[model samples]
Structures are given as C-alpha cells and as structure tokens.
Target chain A: MTIEGQGAVPGLTARIFAGHAGPIAVVVLAIVVIWYAGAVYMNAPRQMDVFKRANADWGAVDLIEGTWAQDRPILPAPHQILAELKKTIIDQKVTSKRSLVFHTWVTLSSTLLGFATGAVLGIVLAVGIVHVGTLEKSLMPWIISSQTIPILAIAPMVVVVLGAIGLKGLVPKALISTYLCFFPVTIGMVKGLRSPDPLQMDLMSTYSASPWQTFWKLRWPASLPFLFTSLKVAVAISLVGAIVGELPTGAQGGLGARLLAGSYYGQTIQIWSALFTAAALAAAMVVLVGVVERVVVRAMGGRP
Target chain B: MTPSPVQSGPAGSDGDSVVRAHGLTLSFQTADGPVHALSDIDLEIGRGEFVSLIGPSGCGKTTLLRAIADLEQPTGGNLSVNGVPAHEARLARGYGYVFQAPALYPWRTIERNVTLPLEIMGMAAGARREKARDYLELVNLSGFEKKFPWQLSGGMQQRASIARALCFDPDLLLMDEPFGALDEIVRDHLNEQLLQLWAKTQKTVVFVTHSIPEAVFLSTKIVVMSPRPGRIIDVIEADFPRERSLDIRETPEFLEVAHRVREGLRAGHSYDD
Candidate 1:
C-alpha cells in the first residue's frame, strides 16, 4: 500500500529552516534595516536644520552621523531605544519615578486585574450563551458592537465617569482593559463551547447526561484549545487597554503617563523608552499566556 | 411501500426483551422539505441477542439504532426500550451507544474517556478507575489506558470507544457502525473480538452496518432496511453457532444469508425516488 506525497520527517536543519529561527531572523533583519533607514531619514531634517541655522558646512555623512547621535531623535533608532531601555531599566533604581520598571509595574498591575476579570466574565457569559439561547441572541451582538467604539475615545469618559463616582486610579483603568479584552474571550468561549460535533452531542444525549454534566465532561474540555488560543489574543489587547486607560488620566504613574510626560517636555528619548517598555510588557504578557496555554492544553491531553 | 409484515423474533420471556420498537417513525423539517429518516422500524432485541441493521446509505439503519438509544424522537409512531419509553429507558441507563467515529474526548486519557459515563452517574472515583481498567482490559487495550485517543491508531481508538461504551454496563449496547471506518483487515479482527465480547458479556447489542458479511457473520438476526421512506425491508433470522470466528464468513451458510440480505436490498429499491 503506497501512500504518495508523504513527506519524510524533516532533519534538524530542515526543521529549523521550515519552522524555527531561519524565517524569524530574516524578518527581524529586514525590520531593523527599515528602522535604521526611517530613523536616519526622520532625524536628518532636524540635524540639517540645526546645521543650517549655525551656518556650518555639513555633508551628508556629517548629517547622518549627527542624526544618529542626537539625544532627541524624532524616531529613535533600534539601538538608541535599546540603549535608552538599558539606561532607564537597568541603571535607575526600581523605586524611582524616572525608572521604566516603576512605570511598567503600575500599568501591568491594572492589565493583569483587567485580564483576570475579562477571562472570568468571558467564560461565564460563554457558558450562558451556550446553555441559554436568549443570551446568545441578545448579548452576543452587543458584546461585539461594544468593541467598535474606540477605546481611546471612551477611555477619558470612563476615567471621568468613574472619577465622578469617587472611584479612581486602578479600577477605572482595569475596567478599560476589561472592556477591550473581554470580547475575544466571550466570542472565543462561545465558539469553543459549541465546538463539539453532532456525534459528540449525540453521545452525550445517549448517556442521558444532564446539561451540566454534558458541559463539564464534553463541552468544557472540548473548548479548552479554543479558550487558550483566544486567551493569547485577549492578554495582549489587555495590555493595550491598560496603557490607553493610563493616557487620559495624566496620572503621574504608568508607562502611558511616562509617554505623555515625555511628549510635553520634548524628551523624545523618554517617550521612545516608554513605548519600548509598553511593547516589551505586551510581549511578556502574551508569552506568559502562551506558556500557560502550553501547560494547560498539554495537561488536558492535547498536543501543545 | 410493501415492507414485509411484522415478523416475530425468537421466543423469549417478556422480561428478556431489552428494546421493543413498534411502528417507529422519525422525520426532519429541512429547508427543502420534510425528510423521513425512519418509518415503521419494528424491532425487538432480546436479552443477549446480537441484532444488526444492514442497509445502503441513507437507509435509516443508523436512525433506527439512534431511535432505540433515544437520541432521536419519533415524530409519528411508538418506540420503546426495555418495555418503557425510549427517553425513560435512557434516563434509567438502559443502553450504552457507540458511534461510527471513535468520538473519544481528545482531551481525556483512554481511561478517563471510559470513566466519563461512570463519573456522570456519580460513581466513586476509586470504583470508576477500577471499572475503566477492567473494560480497557476487556477490549485488549489495558496498557494504553493512560494514552490519548489521537496517540492510538484508528482501530485501537474505535476499540477504546467500545470499551468506554461498555464500562457503564448498560443492559443494552447500541453500536452504530462501530468499525465502519476501519480497514478491512482491522474490521475483521474487531468483528471477531466484538463477537467474543458479546458472548462473554451477554449484553444485547443492536448494531448498525452496511456490510453484508458483517451482518451475516455477527448477528443473531439481520434487519435489512431501505431508503425511500426509510423503513425495514426484511428481517432474516440466522442460526449460526454461538461460538463463531471470522472464518465462518467463508462458509456456505454465511453466503446464503448474505445472498438473502442482498436480495432484500434489491427488492426494497425502486428506479425512481
């Protein structure tokens, strides 16, 4: 019995090239090259403007070197961001308000709170939607449309309304994060809960299992893979929400405040560092979710 | 529409009948129109009897099995299992059903999948594990209890599904093409094992299949069904010895029953729908 087109198990180099480091390295190199070019291009005009004002004889090389070395480049080079990160993150005391670590912690606390809330709410709503048809029809559409209104537009309102209610700081920001991240969890959970095919459903019915038993034994476990995949998406967006929530408050804490503070003071390096910190925070959160997903899905008897 | 008159099954005490469906009918309201899945599916499966429903695609053999298992409700006629309503029988844990596909929860170990019904029925954890192990061993899948379904071959997974169905020890076992997806060699091996399991346990099995040799070789009575209105065409009782093997399929007696089943199938079909 000959089965054609069955590819052999890839050797080490082929496996790496096909799925691991090879494509990643290429894409990262391309992005870095583009970043360097963009940094030089944007910063050159400022550098040239300074040279022109001083009436200095500056060539293209001088302008390039000047732009690259600037303490306040409009768009920081990747290396400049890296250097700024090391200076703020490693050199400064973690307790210092100037430290990126201090700012990141403020934002992350709210992000985690929001993410946990969203996860719980999503699962509950999903269960309801799966079991109760009315919720699926009524709440699902509203949940979907809730995301269409820009978080940036709603952030200030939420913060102000909560402030009016005498609630401040973390709760409002966490609410924003919850607002942003809950949709995917809700949608993904609904999809996951309904993931079982008809035969599984029939099997459950044949067992004379109750709806609750059917859910735990069949539906819930079946939905796990879907839940984890959505959690990855939700966790990253939750970071975005927490940062956005921080923006309207102008609170002297959080990476978003740091970015705003840099913008007001013309400290582009500070702004770039804050941006980089937020990016790193999002990555770390997503990676954490990925690790948890691998553990949970594998423990649930699936190939992770 | 000339389905054979209701033929009585082999004589048995009233208490011996695990499933008794009289004039069972089921229909679905589709976008196109009404589709009849089963009509007047009269069947009485006695205690320890192995009955196979054999027919072509869309012939309602699976439908009849599902109806007996209480997975489908008859829109037009009466259906009973264990001399009670199908749904009531289901609530009483009257039968365990095996589908065409393995349908094992991929997220559960083979043992856990087997223990799910037991768990649902509120059996103690220790008892569930013990029963799961015993059934897994019965299916010749003892060592693989800790493994996931995808880690096993198609045949082994189906066997594990069988073990899962049998673990709860329902009086009746409704199997819908349990080995339909396996290769011929694997199907033959499973058929032999299934017969042995049936003999040892003496559980009444209502099997659905499309294979003539499978029906002839394994069934105490073969119910031939057809598609137009989805009703039974003929019910042929076999007198094959209780102690049987895959080699029995090669004998003249098996061929004679297979020929009658084939003829019944032809008689039930019309050139036009």
Candidate 2:
C-alpha cells in the first residue's frame, strides 16, 4: 500500500535541514569567526612587542598574519589549535607524554572511575531518600549545600588529606569526579522514582506488591529516562572534576598537568590545545551516554 | 435532619458475598479540615455480580472502589473482601484493580504489561506468556501484543489494561471508571464486551462510573450516590438478563430502572445541605 506521508524523501530532507543541520552550521561558523578574531586581538600585543624589540615597523595585515602563526600565541587561532590537536593526538606515539591521546587516557581513567562511583552513590542515595522519609527530610538540604562549596576550594584539601594518608594518583581525582557526578543523578532519580501518578500507586497497592517489587517493576524502568538525562550532564562535569582534581596535585601526566605546564611557561597555544581536547573528550562521553540511553530505552520497549 | 433510611442489599443472590461493608466511612485530613469522602456506606456485593457504583463527581465512588481494593482504609467501618479483611484479601491477591486511566507502563509491550502482575507473583516466564497471550486474545488485542502502550489509541490502551487485570484471573475485579475517558462509541462497545467477559469468567466486579446509562447497561445492581460527605442514596436491583445487547437499553424496564436512578440523584440534591 502506498503511504502518503511515509518515504517522502524531499520533505524529510527539508525537515532535517530546518531542525538540526542548518542551525548547527550557523552557530559553528559564528564561533569560529569570533575565535579567530579573539586570537588576533589577544596575540597582537605580544607580536608587536617582538617587532618593537627589533625596531621594526608593522601594520594590521602583518599583525593578523603573525598572530595566526605565532609559536606561542596568547590565544591561539582555531586552525592552530586544530593542527596542534592533530599532532599531539594523531602523529605522536600513544605512549609518549607529549601525546594528547596519552594524556586523555590518563585523565579519562579517573573520570570514568569517579563517574561510576558517583552514579552508584547517587542511585543509592536517591533510593534511600525515596524509601525513607527521615532521609528525604534531612539529606536533601545537605546534598544541595554540598554542591555550593566550590570544587576548586575542596580539591586541594581532598588531595592533601589523601596524600597525608599515602593515597596518591587516581583516588583523589576520582573522588572529586565522584563528588561532582552524584548530585544530578540523585535529584533526577528522585523525581523519576516519584513520577508515577496517584492512580498508578493505588494499582500497585491493589496488587499488594512489596516495595522492592514496585521499585523494580515500576520505579526503576520509569527512572531510566531521567537517570540517563542526568548522566549526560554528570559525565560532562565528571571530566571537569578530573581535570580540576589533577590541577592542584601537579600530577606529572594527564591533560590537567599539560595545562599547568603550558601556563607556567606562558605557552598559550599548548594550554588552548589541552582545553580543546578536554572539551572534545567531554562531548564524546556525553555522546556515549546518549547512545547507551537509546539502546536501553529501546530494549525496554520504548521508541528510543 | 432526617435519618437516611438504610437499604440491606439485593435479594435473589446466593450464599457468599465477595465484598461486605458495614457503615464504611472514610475521611481525609486536609489542611482546611477533615473531608468526609465515604460516610456510612453499607454495601454488599455477592459473588459473580456486576455491581456499578454510580454517583456525581466527588461522591466517593472511586473511594469506595479503592476501599474494596485495600488501597485506602475506611476511617470507621467493618469492611471485608472474600470473607476476610480488605488488607488480608489484597495480600492474598484476591482482586485485580483497573484504574481510571489505563496506567500501562509506557516502557513495556502490551504482552509484557499483561504479564507484569504474573511476574510480580513470581510466575514462571513460560506460564506468564501463556496467560498474557490468552487474555490478549480475549481482549481482541492479539496482533498488537508487541506494541507499546503509547502506540495504541485510548480505547486500545484501556482494553490492554483490562487484559492485564484479568491475566492473573483474580476472583474479584475492582474497576474505577475504566472507560470514563472513552468516547460514546468505544464506551458502548467496551460495555457490551465487558458484560460478555463477565458472563464467561463469573468474576465479581465492583465498577465505578459517573454515567447512568453505562451503569444501567453494565450492572446487575446499580448504586446511586450523592456528594458532600458522600453517601449511598439508593440501591436498585437492575435484574437485567445476562444474555443481552446494547439494544436492551431502549426497553421500558431499562428506562424504568434508569429513571429510578435519575430520581435518586435528584433526591440526593434535595438534601444537599
């Protein structure tokens, strides 16, 4: 049978363009233009200082070209950052400290470890808050207050305390990410676990299902969509947490270490490359979560 | 204030009543005050009877059904289901409840939704699937077993919910306006289908509805109720034949019963104070 709206290629193409691709292209172009402009603007003074040292005269065109190609720009151009990323991630050996991939692996390990701990902790807390009234009354305010304390301020203390006890390397960093990751999962899961309407609750009571049975059959699957959404947000912040945890410790490896070394020597291009790599890593983690969400929601008979 | 006369129950029913409530009263403790939902409700629903509790909005029809299902405890009453207290009966899996909305889990297929209670009861997977299939076929939803709740229409979703409720084959079914959301045509169709299913299964059903014609068409006994401090106004024996169709609604006896129900509702409003 011929379907009127189904398999309408031109309409589908138009919709995809209108909904996603066109807007993405416009925003990306705008960001690139602003970034290139910022690079030239920020690097112009440093380049001019060099020219002045040589007692040489220059114009805007020279400043623009020199700024884009500077060995150590104050703010690297987008193309320069991209080139550095390719060199560090693609050309350099995976085992080399200079390779961004190696640094990413070091950072990613802590992020994943912290994320897993945080996710489990958050779910357990959420379950506790949901099932136990006293926990809900006492814990929610404290959980919110904990987030208000800046991670940057807490990271050093955590590192030092752990270091004093001879706990070094990954644990401190993973703890920070774990700290960052658990809140959203807890809050989102609470909302999801309570999502079933009054009528649904009444139906469950009629079946005389135990609280455990109700959670598995009704609450958990219902909470999954919310959990995944929170996880996407949590995973992104987890990468940030790892990097911050690494920053205070001055670890000899990881992206955060690379950033610290760059800043110490005023190698702005190196700093920018590390920052961009971190952002890309975070995006990849979020996308990974999104893929898992689709697979799980579909497995549970949702439309994905 | 004049005393409201108490009606015992319908005659001509056999020995056992699935549900027996004596002066069942439920009140909610709201911020404003205690809101009396069901007051002095003495209802007896015998075995294999299709009883409909018809009332105005906020008249405790749903509350009464909920009490029967053991979802809510009556504030002051002696309520029993299957000769045991409501709570015990619930724990014994004595009844299946169909809510006002379909309440089907969006993440489960139609077949899976039907099998959920069975899974909860720790039935074997093979047995659960068999029972689900049988009930789905009974509800005329066999082809759509793999379809999710959202994929179906409102009527289809409600039917799937009914199948889920019946898959476990509970001796009693408590329905809270199961088709109140459906349009006229679908409601009529489901009403007819439910009657047929009732005849076939011999399960005692306590259905709550706002529609008089619906109550008349589906119920063996019609309970007319009124609002503020909700109480039953009249209990009328419908005495309609088990083997019948929607066309029976046009008959004189049906009209007489419906007329009595309307009068009971009008009489309820007379004592609104």
Candidate 3:
C-alpha cells in the first residue's frame, strides 16, 4: 500500500529542505540583501560625484545602477564580485597568473605546509610541557609571550630575516602560518593529553605500564578529539597567516598577492572576490578536518 | 572508636597472606590543612579469601583499598603485598584494582578493553587476543567482543571491566564499590557472579562497599569501618560455604552474620559526637 497521499503530510523532499536547507538559505539571502544595501550606500557618493563632474543629469534608478556597476566602486556589489570570481576562477586558465585558481593553489600549498609543521611543533611542545616540569615552567611562559607579539608585526621581520638567510618563497610564508597556528594546537593538545581522568591514570599505574606506553595507549587516543578541534581552528588561522605573509612580502602569486594587486589597482570587485575565495578555502579545510575527525571517532567505536 | 584487633596472617586454610597492613595512614595535605584519609589501619588479607571493607562515605575504606593498590601513598605504617612493599607489588603487577565506575575507555571495544593491561605489559597480539577471549567468556561477555563500552548496559559494562581486571590474571583483585552505581537487581546478580569468579580463580579479593547485604553476601571477612579520621572499628568473620549461592542470603547463618555487621556499623557511628 502506498503511503504517499495522507492528509497534511508534507513530502519527504520538502520536509528535508525545510529542516536543513531552509534556514541556511534564508540567512544567506538576508546577508546578500544587506550586502547589496551596504554597497549602494557606500558607492552612491562616488557615482553622484562622477555624474556632477560629467554635467549629466541622473535619476535615482540611474544613480543606483551607476553605483552597482562602477568600474572601481568603494564597495563592490555582490553580483560584481561574483562576476569577477567567475572570470578569474572559471573563465581564465588555471595556469594563468590572472586565474584565482592559480592564486588559490599558491596560497594553499603554504597553508598546508605551515599547518603540518605547526601541528608537529605544537604536539611536541605539548608533550614536553606535560612530561617535563621544567619545560612546562620555562617554555610555556615564552610560548605565551611569543603569541603576544602581534603576528602582523612579526610577519615582515620573519620574512626579512628568513629572506636574508636565502630561505625565501613558501618557507617564509609557511613559517608565518606556523607561528599563527601553533598556539591553539599546543594549548588544546596539552589539555587533551591530560584529559584522562584519575581513574584511567590509576589504571595505567596499576598495570605497571611505562610512561611511554601510557602516552601511546591512553593520552594519545584521549587527545585525538581535542587535536581535531584545535586542527580546525589551526587550519583556518593558518590560511589567515598565509594571506598576511603574502601582504608584507608583496608576493607575485597567491590569494594574498591577488588581494594586494586588487588593492593597488583600487579594484574593489577583485579584492572582494579574493576574500570570498579565501573564506571558502578556509571553510573547505575545516570541513576536511571534521570529516577526518568523524572517521577517527567512528573507528574508535564512538558515535560520529 | 578503638582500632580493631589486627587479624593474624594466613587466616583459616587460605594459606599465606597476600596483603598485610600495619598502622597504614594517609593524610592529604589540603589547603585548609592536612586531612587524614586513613589513620592507623591494620589488616591482613589471606590468599584465596574474599574480604569486603564496609563503611560509610569518608570512612577511608576506599582509601585503604587505594593504599593496598599503591594508588595512595601511606604517610605512616608498613604495608606489604605478596611479601613485598605495596609499591613493589604494584610494579610487579601483583594485583588488579577496579574503580567504582566501570572506567572502561570509550574508544576500546569490550575485548580490546580486556586486553588493555596485556597490551600495556607488552604481551604479543595473538596471546592478548586469546586471553581477552577467555576472560570475556569467563565474564559471560563472549559474543560482545566487538561492541564498544557505550553499547553495553551499565551492568554489562561493569562486567566487561571485571573481565578486563581478570584478564591479566592478577592473584589479588582490589575492587572499590564495583557495583555501587548499578541498580539493586544488577548488584545482586553481579555479587553472585563475583563469588563464582573468586571461587574459580581462587584469587584473593578485597572489595569495598557500603551495602551490608553485599558485604555479607561476598566477603569471608568483613571490615566494618568509621569516618572522622577513617579507621576500622570491627572485623567480623563470615563462615559461609565457598560454593554458596544467592539463596544463602535467606539462610539463618547469613542473616546472623549480616546482623552482626549491621551492629558493628552502628557501633562505629555511635562515637561520632
């Protein structure tokens, strides 16, 4: 018997969309609407000045259109940024320097490298902090103080110093990302590694398990959830680091370079497009980490 | 309350003593001041005997157990396990201690949980698996090897934990209220199974519980204790048969022993003022 035509029964597809996609769609729509309004408000004076200079009369509709369609508006409209994204990311060849795809790849490489190095560094530091009392006392203060020195202020110095030593290109940029990302990872991991309850620790002691064995069997696994959590934050911030790294160096490639070029040219659409692309990239990386977390949690017999 | 007379080592036909404590005391150096957890505890547990420490909260029954397990450092007194110092016995893996909570690692499956101690002790993979299998079967958890700790009921999880404790084949089992969190029905069932386990393995069991029925049901000797500096007030002997069942609880002999334990517990509380 078909259960399709019951009274007041919403279709499954409709129900699914209502529960999951509906709210997100509304939020995005609201954001786009607000963005469009902000664009017109910011760009109108420039359009008005252009019209007055050209001795051309313009109605409200013309003025609105002018603001939205400006060659170099103060704040580009959503459609303009989307058009620029399509031109650079989809229309242009990926190998082309003008292509956002190429730029994204350049930035992504450094981001990944920095994230890997930073994660390893963070884990090592955390382990040392947990196991060695002196390291905890000595290294922790310095580590905290290191983060207090603004990354932006340090980024240029790091680039210049590393460049002087002939360590240029990806290494310098990745190092900046490493600097920005490692703090969260270190803090999260220290907490995670120590997350095991007293009972668990007591159990290990009872088994006469070596400290090494205890670390591998109990602390490592216990720290996994925390590690993944820190990784998501680390990955996202590392992208920020990569972008900032590109800024001081005036890099020839990368999303940061695209943003730099766009800012130099006063190409608002290009800048906004680069920003959206960076945001999408960060989201993708976090999602990738979350996927791995799910797989690990499931494998360890937890509900993913 | 006066300290109970120290039970001489090698009680009855149980042979040599497994755990012997003389004036065992633990004081936690708290912010307020030093807090006595256990004071002047003296006891001797024989091989292959089930001994239960029955006391109220803050009575140092668990502290005493922790002392035996070497989980807590005794500030004053001499304690030995298997003729060596408690710490040394722990290093030798001479005993397995079970906490009030199952404390099973959420990440490990039932069988894997059982094999944890073996893995830590560097037992080979094949051997660990075999021993895990045997212990799981012994605890009646054979088919649920792949199931995680969270998948099982509270009683089952506790049983799996017991299997984990037993897998390493430690001659002495130190359990601190293993079934305290469980329902009365589950507790009774587990108490029976524990008795069967103790009988089969012939291992010395030091159990901690607040329930008198549980203590009388399981222990061949019950150490009734008091709080406020935490000391034992009385030690009562339970001479029930080794092969006894749950039906033994209804027997006149079991009730008499249980009544004596209740009196000892009340008498321990009388000096609270």
Candidate 4:
C-alpha cells in the first residue's frame, strides 16, 4: 500500500541542535565577557586604590555616584570585591579555617543536614496524608498555618528554648532549616501522588496488580518531576533556615555570622559578598537537583 | 438451543468451542435505582469464531462482553470459558480485551504499551521484544514502536492498542466497540485488517458494536440485543465466504446479511420501546 511513505521526515535532529545551540552559546559568551570586564576593572591597582579611598570616605552619595575618594573607606567597590575574590580563590588558601571557607563549610553542613532531614520527613508525611483521608483533612490546615508564623520572630525563642535544654550549634540551625524545607515537599508530593488518572489505575487493577506495585510503577514515576521541583524549593528554603538560625544565635562562623558582623561594623561589602555566596550555593544545589532529575527520569525511560 | 457446546474442531484444539455463557443476568446499583443491565443472555462463541453483539446505546452489549471477560459479574447466571469460572478462565486462559476507547497508558511508548501485559506476565526480555515486534507488525505499526501515544493519530493509537491486546496471543479476544470512535475510512481499514488477523490467528472473538452494518460485515454470528434489561432478541448467521474482502461489502450476500441484521435490530428496538 506504500503506507511507509507516510512516515515523518527525519529532520528533528538538526532542528533540535539548531534551536538549542545558538541561545546557549550566546548566554555563555555574555557571562564570560562580563566576568572578564569586571576582572580587568577590579584588578587594576590605581582603580582599586581610588575605589578603596572612596568607600572609606562613606560619602555614600559618591559611592552610589561611582566617584573615588582619597582615603580608604570601610566598604570597598566592585574592584575591591573582585580583588578580594581573586586573592581568596587564586593566590591565598582562603578555603582553610583562617579564611571564609571555614564559615561557608559550617553553613553548608547545617543546610545539607537540615535539608536531608526535612526532605525525608516531608516525603513520609506526604505519603501518609495521601494514603489517609483523615490525616489529610486534619493536618493540612495546621501545616499551612505553621508557615504563617514568621521564622524571624520564632528564631530567637527557638534558640533560647533549645539553649535551656542544652541543645545548641547544629541542632537549632538544622531544626530551623527542617521547618522551612518540609512544607513544600509535602505539598508537592501530595499533588504528585494524586496525579495519575483513574483509567491508569484501573489498568493496574485489571492486571490484578497489588497496591504497592501500582504505587511503585505508576504513582512514583509520575511524582518524580514534581518531587525534584519541590526539592529545589526545599533546598533553597533550608539554606534560608540555616542563615536565619545563625542570625538569632550569633554564630561564631558561617555566612550568617559574616552577615551579622558586616551589619555591626557597617561592612556592607562583606554582607553583599556573603549574600552573593549564599545565593550561588543555593543555585548550585538547585542545579544539582536538575541533574539528578535528568538521570532518574532517563532511567525510568522518560525523556527530559 | 439448550446451550449445547458448539464444537467446530477437535477438543482443546485452537478452533474448538472456548466460551459458553447461559442465562446471564446482570444488575447494577445505579443512582436512579437497581438497573438490570442484561438478562437471559445465553450465548456460546466457538474458538476462532468472530461474533458481534449489536444493539442500541444502552442495550448492555458491552456489559455482556465484560461479563464474558470477567470484568463484570452477572447477578444471576453462569458464564464459563474453557470449563472454568470466568475469572479463573481469565486468569488461566489470559484473554486480551480492548475497550471502547484506546486505553493506552500515556506515559509509555507504543512499544512499551504493547509490552505492558508481557511485563506483568514476567516474560523474558528477548522473548518480549520479539513478541512486541511481531504484534506491532501484525497491526502494521512496525516503525512507530518508540512513538508515544499522544504523537499518534486516533486511528494509529487504536491500532497500537489492538497490537497490545494481541501481543500475548490470547485464546479469546473481547472487544467493546473498539472501532466505534474511528472515522468511516479508518473503520473500514481496521475492519479489513481485523478480518485478516482473525483469519490468521483463529482466535475466539466476542465483539460489541452498535453499527448493524459493521456487525453484519465482520461476524459469523450477530447477536441482536434489546435495551432496558437487555435480552438477546435474535441471532443472525452470516453465510458469506470466510475469505471476504472490503469489496464484499458491495456484494448481494453482504447486503442481505446487513438487511437481516438491521431488521433484527429494528425488531429489538421496537420491542424494547
């Protein structure tokens, strides 16, 4: 019947390559150019001195106006930040205890531990709630209400209460991260588990498949995309929790401590730098989730 | 007919009588009330026989097929396939069933969808792949193995679903208006292919359809049913040659069989109303 002639043309490969390559290449080139420009401006010795002097003057007006002062101010310019980043990253071993790396490590550890704990608890809760109608109806409202109480207002009380019980350091910070991270995972997972259609469920039933088999095969695979999406949100919130935990307790190291120290002495540059580092770390964590998503979905025979 | 076992070939042979359901009565607890979906539905389909059940929309044709497939339990009556209870028959005999719509799993590729039953049966990987390819070829969907259900047309998806049903080489095939959703052209094409497949495999088929012409064109026996407590009104036997083609639809015997089916349908509808 010559029906084979009706098949689709094999041009999808070239089309996909052309569609993705151009935009990706342009974005990468733009980032590189911007980084090079910033590096050149920040590393120039004369520009660095002039910017340091202006920052020291605290003529915050001139600071915003991009003018230079004679003497070094407390806050450094973009040039100064670039020089500091280069010195810390390239020349000096800033990753050690004497540098910012020790603080970053402290913050990262708490965030990771809290994120893991929160994610596990949240998934277990979501599974329970989804399976049990009474728990879903009763607990969902309270979980939502818990989010309304601002973490900032509660952080001090948590620190004091835990301190009275002699629990300090990582525990309090991990608790805060867990509190912030769990809600999204629970909500996302509930929706995901319920995402499978009735017909699909019936198909499983028609096969005489047990409840566990149906869950593992259909519901779990369907929930994956949602799980990863919520994981990204949960990870970011965990980092926020760690930083917030540090704020009330006044931790000796970590980015939160750096932020508090910067605010105390009005070292706005140090605060900004720490804030940037936290943001970068959060972005990296989310990207890690995306990579895992690709691998897992592919393993499940799904296209990205 | 006192529900005799209609044997066409040797006992336990491929073309021997496979299913016999007598005095099947089905009632459903509908929102309106307890509705009798089917009653006094005595039928026997021989192995490799292509039989169609035709009636009005609410005439319980699908219900009858579902009863045979063990998907629906009859309120009062007996349904036995291969001398076993319908459920046991289904579990042991493993009949393939196709619904009104192509209930293809959206997440699976076409090949994967066809492989689903095999996966459930725990067939070895190499054997499953070979069977999947063979069934896909039978349904004329050889190259579309990797395509998702959403990527295919309605006709193609339905064909893929048919492939899925046929993959395990089931003894009896239960179809509930499987081609009722397709357009006339696609329907004609699928009907021809189905005839060829039936001829090749000699599988027992119990097809439910509303179209009188389709029932006449495809079946060796057409069981005309009445609605509102559906009962078998009449059974019209097709006297055409087994090697019938699409062009046979234009022939005199074909027209005669279709006319008798229509008359039976009209009689049933008038009696019901």
User: Quick one: best lDDT, which candidate?
Assistant: 3
Model 4 lDDT, residue A199, Cα: 55
Model 3, span A1-304: residue lDDT tens: 9766787788877886878688788899999999888989999998899999999989999998998999999989999988999999899999999999999999999999999999999999999999999999999999999999988899999999999999988999999999989999999999999999999999999999999999999999999999999999999999999999999989999999989999999987899899999999999999999999999999999863
Model 1 per-residue lDDT tens digits across residues A72-189:
7888788878888898889999999878899999999999999999999989999999899898899988998899898899999999999999999899999999998888998898
Two-way TM-score contest, 2 vs 4, winner = 2
Docking class of 3: high
True contacts kept of 2: 0.79
lDDT of 1 by residue, B86-148 (tens): 889988888888999999888889999999889888999999999998999999998997899
Q: Compared to the true structure, candidate 1 yields what TM-score?
A: 0.93
lDDT by residue for model 2 over B48-123, one digit each (tens)? 8898998888899998998888888899989999999998999999998898899998888999899988998999
| Weakest ten-residue segment in model 4 chain A by summed lDDT | A64-73
Q: Per model, how much of the real contact set is kept?
A: 0.79, 0.79, 0.83, 0.14
Instruction: State in Å the error of residue B144, model 3.
Output: 0.8
Superposed Cα deviation of residue A97, candidate 1 (Å): 1.4
DockQ (0 to 1) for model 2? 0.68
lDDT of 1: 0.87
Score every model by TM-score. Answer: 0.93, 0.94, 0.95, 0.75
User: Given candidate 4, what's the lDDT at residue B82?
Assistant: 71
- Across A151-232, the per-residue lDDT of candidate 4 in tens digits comes to 9999889888999999988988989999999999999999999988765665665566667877777887788888998999
Query: What's the DockQ for every one of the candidates?
Result: 0.65, 0.68, 0.83, 0.19
Chain A TM-score of prediction number 2: 0.91
